[model samples]
Target: MSKLVSENISTLRPYEPGKPIDELERELGISNSIKLASNENPLGPSPKAVEAMQSLLAEAHMYPDGAAFRLREAVSKKFDIPMNEIITGNGSNELLTLAARTFACPGENAVISDYGFVAYKIVLTAANVPFTSVPVQPGFEQDLNALAAACDQNTKLLFLANPNNPTGTYVGRKALENFLKEVPPHVIVVLDEAYVEYADADDYTSGLELRGLRERLLVFRTFSKCYGLGGMRVGFGVGPTELIDYMNRIREPFNVNILAQAAGAAALFDQDFVERTVKANAESMVLFKRALEDMELKYTPSQTNFLLVEMPEADKPLGGAVYQAMLRHGVITRPMAGYGLPNHLRITLGTPAQMERCVGALKAALEEVQ
Candidate 1:
């Protein structure tokens, strides 16, 4: 069995997703648990998306359009990008994997922020493409300068997550623009903007707005966050036609399922729902920050729908213990141990009431764990 597995695959560590609410309830023998672990849109799916998906339930017998025509059309209209430059995926996760496999050859490698999305390392390694992790700056912001300096001719792909997960830190427009210019021409930059909709920062510029800055740049987005289509797994990438064409060559046929395609397209038109989701996230974020402040818990300033909260010192209980204690209180949060931040937790914003409950649970958990 050992000899059967590829050396790279054998050594690779699997990604641990957040515990699902149902699974937690079953294991803990509890009911009505609130999960703030996976950075999901607390509002759930859009009404228009539901209607569209329901209308297509009868067409389950037929395979999805392999090209994801309707969804691409909607994306194109929404972003003003051409259809040929858009590539759809099961989720943006799949697109990240595809970018790794399609661009990086055996000898070439990719580069990512140290605390960037874990999926980048997973996908790159799984594709047998080596990568370098550039350490984030003091504020947990991706050091764009260091990342640019780390790239050599062998660097084929560079993965950057704006409002990076597990930390919720972002580089502003000017910094991003300067960094893009500094990157070598041969390296293809993959900008993951999954949380772009929630960012109200004045200087935050989506990679979609800077697509013309680099010929090889690709901007990937998902309906999972703001659009509330996590279960449907709808994601799309915008890039030059040539690059997108190359990626499509290796893209799985019917990757975007029938229902997902319908749902994503409808979700695009439901701007009102997205606006409401953003508003709720802002309100909840403020409440959570205020609570954290009152508790003397340090937290990162976030431009997205989640907060990265630091626990007590290493001498005290860390994120894992706190997470477990919180679970006993019927609240599920993401522990940062796996991401090498053993003393921190990543909490997704819910409704204000939910945040208050979460704050109460956190206080109780701290008392119990400490």
Candidate 2:
């Protein structure tokens, strides 16, 4: 069986997502566990989106529109992009992999940040394309200079996660623009903006705004983070018409479901819901940072909905122990050992009440672990 597997596939390590609430509850025989692991919208789905999905439940017998026409049109109007340049996916994750598969050839390479989204490496590897991991600079920021230097003639694709995950850092407009100018024209750049909705930085630039600056740029967005539609698994990408057409050629028919299409379109129209979600996340993030300050815990200041907290040094590695302690107290967080930060934990900011509870649990967990 091992011999039958391709070297790339055989050596690959799958991504480990945050633990689900139900799974943690079952494992600990606990009730009412608060999960602030995966960065999710604490406000839940928009009422309009819920209504739209519910209305479509009766149409389950029919297959989804293969092209996601309505959703694409809504996205085009919302973002001011042409419909032909947009493509939908099961999630932004799918589109990322699709880009790798469509562009990367065997023995070629892609460029990604060392601590960027883990899924990029997985997808590139699965496509049998080797990739270079550019080390992050101070404060966990993507080293755009190193990334540009790493690319050569063999580089086919580049994946950049603005307001990158786990570390939650971002690149400013000038830096990104300068970097883009240096990248080879033949290399396709995929800007993964899954958490862009939650980012409030004044200088942060959405790749969509810079699409015209580069011919080979693709911007990916997802409803999973700020829209509270993780369960629906719907995301969209905007790129050159030719690149989008190539991705569509390889896309599975009905890749997005009927309910997802309806909900996504409704979600886009419900600006009030998105505003409220953003407001709540902004307030909760402040509260979490203050709590960490009071606890004398150092953490990465983030523009996204999560914080990467550095645990105090103890006799042993405390990340896993602190995580277990939080779990026992009915609070779930993501340990960052897999990202090579064994002493750090990544925690999602939840609603106000949930944040309070999480702080309390963290306080208790820290005492126990110490």
Candidate 3:
């Protein structure tokens, strides 16, 4: 098996998603567990999206439009981008993989931050392309300058995530603009804005707004986080028409299912739900942050719907142990050992009531571990 497999694929360690509530409850012999590990929308999908999917249930036997025409039209109207420059995917994860496969080859490398999304590394490795993981600045912020410096003639791609996952840090608009200008024209920058809707920071601008700065820039957005369509698995990428065309060539037919297309299209028009969701997240985030302050825990101030919290430095267990203890209390949160922050955890903001419950569980867990 090893002989038959490419070395890059053979040595790869697959991305691990957060633990599920059902699996945790079954293993612990408990019930009513709440999960805050994955940055999921707690308010659920929009009524319009649900209605659209429900309307299409009888047509399940038919194949999805391979071109994703309706969804692409909705996206175009919503984002003011041309439909010809858009490509839909099963999820934005698929688009990332497609970009890696389409633009990169063996001996040509990609660039990413050490604490960037794990999926970037996975996709590049799966494509047999090596990547340079630039060390982040203090406080886990991506070092855009260093990342730009790391690129050379061999660099073909660069993956950047605004309000980056597992850390929740973001680069300001001016910094990002400068970084984009500094990167060589040969490198195609993949700007992933999966949490763009949740970001309330005035200085944080979406790459969609800066597409003209770099000819090779590709911006990826997802329905998973803000639209609550994670289960449906719908996401899309917008870029240069030629780049989009190349990715489309390699995209599987019916990459996004029929229900996902309908749901995503309807969700784009349901801005009311998105606004309500953001408002609720803001209120709940205050409560969550207050509780963390009361516990004297340090956390990275986030622009998105989650916080990256550090464990107490003295006389407390590491993230993994604290995570296990919290599980016994029926609250599931993500530990950050895989991202090399062994003492930190990434927690999603939930409803006020859920956050209150989660805070109590976390306090108890921290006490037990101490």
Candidate 4:
């Protein structure tokens, strides 16, 4: 093997996505199984987006606009940010990678919570950059104070999930403002809001309002969440024009396909559908909480689309047991042992019917084994 390849590539562990419905069904030898594993919109892609993409499918052979013109303009207008401040990505995950490569270098480091979005950590490692992992507070909340304390002169990047994946705990606007006050000028913070549309708390930071301070803060969002364009693989980042412009130079010219560009632009205009998804998430999260409470299962109060349920000490591993049970019952949920939460599982908020079936399956699974 050529020594030209960086050793960083070998040590990196690949990301494990939520199992696909077909794969699960084929493995289990069943049909009509419901998936609550991926934090995807159970409502599927938006009608408007789907229609737009279907029309553009014939042009698939054509290269995508590297600039992602219309989609960028749509996102900029929706958030009231300048066109110059936005950059599109294959997905927000690629944006995270771009940040690590654009800002941090071999000797530099980034700061991330111990159990934050897996993408941030994965990206940092891929760039061969060192990072400090701050432990999440009890109930999986980001410990901003601890993270602040962890920062040193070598730290060039900071990554956080607004409503963290798996945990779904959010840092309020006031807290974020306070933390930003002390954030060093040299340190750039990337706030990943993959599920921002689902957050209902009054104190939740939209990352939209932080545009004025773009020099130090970059807000990442995706069409994959409430916008229902996950299949299109479209997402964008907002930051100070100065910083975003620098990252833009490194992006592939045809990174975003024409269909994704078209669908993303249309999805932005589908305001009513977006509202409905957000409303549904808010409503279903309430029912999920009530059901967990009724069953005496301890779970963190989530403002995001998913709920993280903590399991009790048991003979079998929490990840293996609940996952197997849910699979057996045709309800798929994510086990988060990879983020170091071996005792917890992350369940995405599906449709009301799906949630009802999932909870029932989970309860039955617990009963069957324990």
Candidate 5:
């Protein structure tokens, strides 16, 4: 079996997702556990999307529209981009891998931020494309200068996670513009904006705004985060027509299910629902930050709907212990050891009730660990 597997795939470690609520409850023999690990919308799916999915239940037996025609049109109208520039996927995760598969080769390399989304490294490694990880700057933000310096003629893809996961930090518009200018024309730049809808920073720029600036620029968006459609597994990529065409050619037929397409298209039109989610997240973020401050704990200021909290130093590493303590108390948060931040935890902001529960659990967990 080892001999049958490619060396790259054989050595690769699979991604570790956040523990599901049911699985954690079963393990601990507990009920009503709240999950703030994966950055999912706590308000649940949009009402419009739900109605659309319900309407499509009778049509589940039919195959999905391979081109995602209605969804693509919806996205185009919303973003003001041409329909040909869009390519839908099972999720943005698949599109990220598809981009690498379409553009990079074994000997060529890709550039990614050290603390960027873990999926980028996984996809590149699985495809046998070596990748250079540019170390993050102060405050856990992506080092655009370092990324530009790391790329050379052999670099094929560059993955930048704006409002990066685990850290929840982002780059400003001017910095991104300058960085784009420095990047060579041959290198494809991928902006993973899964959490863009929640960003409230004055300087944050959506890669969608830079569509014609660089022919190789690919912006990935998802229905998973702000749109509350993670279970549906639908996302899309916006890039030049040629790049989108290449990705579409290699993508699996009916990659996105009929329900996902219907839900995603409906979600796109439900701007009011999205606005409510974002507004709720903003209020919750403030609550979490204030609670952390009151407890004398440190955290990164975030543009997205999550925070990266640093646990107090103890006799040993506190992140894992704190995470375990929180889990035992029916609250689930992500320990950042896998992202090389053993002292930190990534917590997704939920509703006010959920946030209050999480903060209470955190205080209790700290007391126990300390």
Candidate 6:
């Protein structure tokens, strides 16, 4: 065998996604399983998106438009940003990786919260760029002041996941604005609003509202979460046109595939689907919290579709074993060992019946272990 692999990738661990339905079914000889592990929509993809993809299938033989011009136009109009300021990616994950490559060099560094999104560290590691992760506050809230302290001249980017993943905590508009105000001009803030749509804080400011600070912040949004198109992996970033121009240079011409582009554009206008998803997710969150309260279990309050529950016991396959047991009972939730929270699990809020299954399975799993 030839030793041709780059050292960066040779030892790097790839992102391990949750077990699929087929794999679980094969292992346990069970069928008709429900997966809330991946944070997918129980209501399914938008009808508009489905119809759009169907119409575009016949054109699959042709190469996709390199720039994704039409989709950019729709995004710009919807977000009220200029078309030149946007860069579409396969998903927000791709954009995160691309940002590392575009801005940070071999010796430069990026700053992030210690318990933040897994990809922030993964992408930096994969790129061979140094990174510093400041620990969060006791309640898993981002310490923006600590982030400022962590950065120096080498820090090219700062990733802030509002309504942060796994933890699902968010800062109000005033807090974020204050953080941005103190941010140095040299560093670009990547505000990841992947779960912002589900965040119902009255004072929360949409990342789109920060367009005036284009040079200092780039806001990343996904069609995957609120729009229900995770399988297609569609997302975009709005920011400084000059910065986007440089990043777009490194992107694959057809990074956002034709089908995803078409579907995403259609889904953008499917307000009915979005409204229904937002409403159902709100109800599910309340239901879960009430169930946990009744059971006397402790859980973090979340503005997003998922919640982080403190187990205070079990990690990994033990935590994951609990996740497996849940599968056997026709429910699936995500273990957080991979995210360095060995004692916590992230459960996506589902439809009413699905939430009921999740709660029942979780209680049984804990009792079984106890």
Query: Would you list the C-alpha lDDT of every candidate in the order shown?
Result: 0.93, 0.92, 0.93, 0.85, 0.92, 0.86
User: Candidate 5, which segments miss by more than 4 Å at Cα?
Assistant: none
Please count the clashing residue pairs in each candidate, in the order shown.
Answer: 0, 0, 0, 1, 0, 1
Q: Cα RMSD for candidate 5?
A: 1.1
TM-score, candidate 3, is: 0.98
The global Cα lDDT (0 to 1) of model 1 is 0.93
lDDT of 2 by residue, 99-169 (tens): 98898877689999988988998999989988899998888989999998899999999999998997999
What is the C-alpha lDDT profile of model 4 across 144-179, one tens digit per residue? Answer: 988877889889999988888878889999888877
Model 1 scores worst on lDDT over the 10 consecutive residues at 311-320
Q: How well does model 4 score by local distance difference test?
A: 0.85
Which residue pairs clash within candidate 6? 317-321
Worst 10 residues of 4 by lDDT: 206-215
Off by over 4 Å in 2: none
Give all TM-scores, in the order shown. Answer: 0.98, 0.98, 0.98, 0.96, 0.98, 0.96
lDDT of 2 at 316: 73
Model 6: lDDT equals 0.86
What is the lDDT, from 0 to 100, of the residue 97 in candidate 2?
83
lDDT (Cα, 0-100) at 198 in candidate 4: 83
Question: Which residue pairs clash within candidate 2?
Answer: none
lDDT comparison, 2 vs 4, better candidate: 2
What is candidate 5's lDDT per residue for 1-370, written digit by digit as tens? 4488888998998999999999999999999999999899999999999999999999988999999999999999998989999999999999998998999976799999988899998999888899999998788878899999999989999999898887899998999888888899899999999999988889999988776577789999999999999999999999999999999889999899999999999999998999999999999998999999999999998888899999998777799999999999999999999989888999999999999999999999999988
